[model samples]
Target: MTDITSTELKQRQSAGNAPTIIDVRETWENEEGRIEGSQNIPLGTLPDKLDELEALKDQEIVVHCKGGGRSASAKAFLVQHGFKNVRNLLGGFQGYQQA
Candidate 1:
């Protein structure tokens, strides 16, 4: 999967056709602020939420964290777990804010 830039995400969001977004940051970090409709699923809990996330396996999903690292890991995990379309938000939330 390719990485998506914040500018592209904002464009998709404004068009009301954004892909499903996953926030892989800690609960506290996520509470600080986040993409409007991104679902918060802390990285550590992803395995536990596999069942809950099963339905999205074939959907285009984007993952992000405070920066890019955690979300990169999340994207790799999802891909390994059979998710068909997963991408990391380039530069993550900070980048999104900057954009």
Candidate 2:
């Protein structure tokens, strides 16, 4: 799976070129905070939400969670489902906060 740094994501967002960012963490976790424009679709429910993301199949997608594990799994699932461009945020949201 491809990996991207939080810094790179920030730069893309600032330049108005950010891809769709998916937060695979649970709702409760999201109450704390999340990337400003990230879409929350918890890992557990992604299978049912595939259609919601269909329009983004050809666009870049960045997935993240509390750490890298969930995002890796999400990336795999996306690729298997025919998503052409997907990347896991290395270190996930924690990394983003650190940055």
**Against the true structure, whose lDDT is highest?**
1
Off by over 4 Å in 2: none
Tell me the deviation in Å of residue 73 in model 1.
Answer: 0.6
- Provide the clash count, candidate 2: 0
Please write out the lDDT profile of model 2 over residues 1-99, one tens digit for every residue.
468999999999999999899999999998899999998999999999999899999999999999999889999999999999999999899999998
Clashes of each: 0, 0
Total backbone collisions, model 1: 0
lDDT of 1 by residue, 1-99 (tens): 789999999999999999999999999998999899999999999999999999999999999998899999899999999999999999999999999
For model 1, the stretches where C-alpha displacement exceeds 4 angstroms are: none
How far out, in Å, is residue 24 in model 2?
Answer: 0.2
- RMSD, one per candidate, in order: 0.5, 0.9
